[model samples]
Target: RDEGLHPAIRIALRAITDFAIPFQKSSKLYWRYFLVPEAEFTEEAIPQITAPVIEVKKAKNEVPEIKEELQIIKTMPNEPREKIEMVISEPKKEEMLTPAAKEPLIKNPAIEKKEILPEQILDKKALKKEAKKPKPKPKKQKSDKKEEGFFNKVKERLASKSIDITDIIGIKKDELILKVKKEKKEELLIAYNKRKITEGDIIEAHKKAKEADLPYSILNLSGIPKKIQDLIEALKDISSIEKL
Candidate 1:
């Protein structure tokens, strides 16, 4: 032979017969999804094949499998699982001054508030010291005392003259005319004569006496001495009296 086989291998190659694959006789390791069997159809079974229904069978203890990328690992049945602990870190004291993005969290207190004062917090001692300070009394002027004295004297004199003091209106500048009836003037002279002489010659001496007809007659209203000279010189330097 031209090949490397001996002369006996060349004679055995001439007796070959079948080379077709036997799928039914293959091992289980050689199975594939492409080899699944489909339903056959005949003329009588064509109507049943046109509307075929599919049913899936499930096991009682079947658990759904998860993909390997989810990082889940399977362990032995007697192995214990470790406890997962979480760690939360506290922020530094310096970082709290200027918070993140210069904005404060809603749960944090932004500022401290001052306490308010209660009512009725005033000092009682201060109020008592102010109350103990003496208030000034008003002093009376000298002119007021003099006016009161003159009014009292005038009221006493006018009240004793049988004159209604309320009717004594005012002074008329010491220059107004006085009105006296003639009979009253004669009676005034007679009264003056009685004040001067004895009782029996009093009525006769005034009838022979020369008459001085005056507008007014003052009959010695002062009960001190009943003198005609004091009546003429009474209250000479006094000015007009004022009303209260």
Candidate 2:
């Protein structure tokens, strides 16, 4: 006999104790009894059931085929073709007939052509006019002439004062004029002869000459000494002094 325990209560106990049971031992007991069948549950086998035999039906038969007869054709021999010949006719020439009356031949009028000469082709009068014209002469320039005159005047003035003017030719006029003003005329002439005249010497001389109401031209003649008289007489012929 079994206890009157509810299925839910038994399931709850098994759920709680499931961890305590070994899985391998539970599987061996389940396959041994629950899955295997006993000899009392076996039934006897019935006699073998037989099936009816079947027959295969045959299809309708087709008609018999006949072989076709072939006919052989023979080709006729070809005849040779003939070429046709063409005849060409030559053209006939017609003779020219003469006129009943012949006319007299007339000549054309002659043309008169003139030839032109080279002299006749050009304008002779124009050539002659150009050849007859006179050429212009160049005018003389005077600035250099004036400068030469100024230098000549300076030379004459210096020479009158017994100054050696030849050696002073290349000296600038302005510088020479300045030298004639500062120093005594004799002293300045000496310095000028020695090529040592100062600008102050010339300025003082120019001032003295101005104060005395005399021209620089007069001052140029102020320093003549008796010693240079013979020298002046000897240079007279060869000097431009004559021209001055």
- Candidate whose lDDT is highest: 2
Instruction: Give the worst 10-residue stretch by lDDT in candidate 2.
Output: 83-92
For every model shown, what is its TM-score relative to the native structure? 0.18, 0.17
Residue range 93-177, candidate 1, lDDT tens digits: 4533433413422221333355655433355656787899898867567655654555454445545754333222122222111
Give candidate 1 misplaced runs (Cα > 4 Å): 1-91, 99-136, 141-144, 166-244
Task: Flag regions of model 2 displaced more than 4 Å.
Answer: 1-141, 169-244
User: Candidate 1's C-alpha lDDT?
Assistant: 0.31
Against the reference, the lDDT scores of all candidates come to 0.31, 0.35
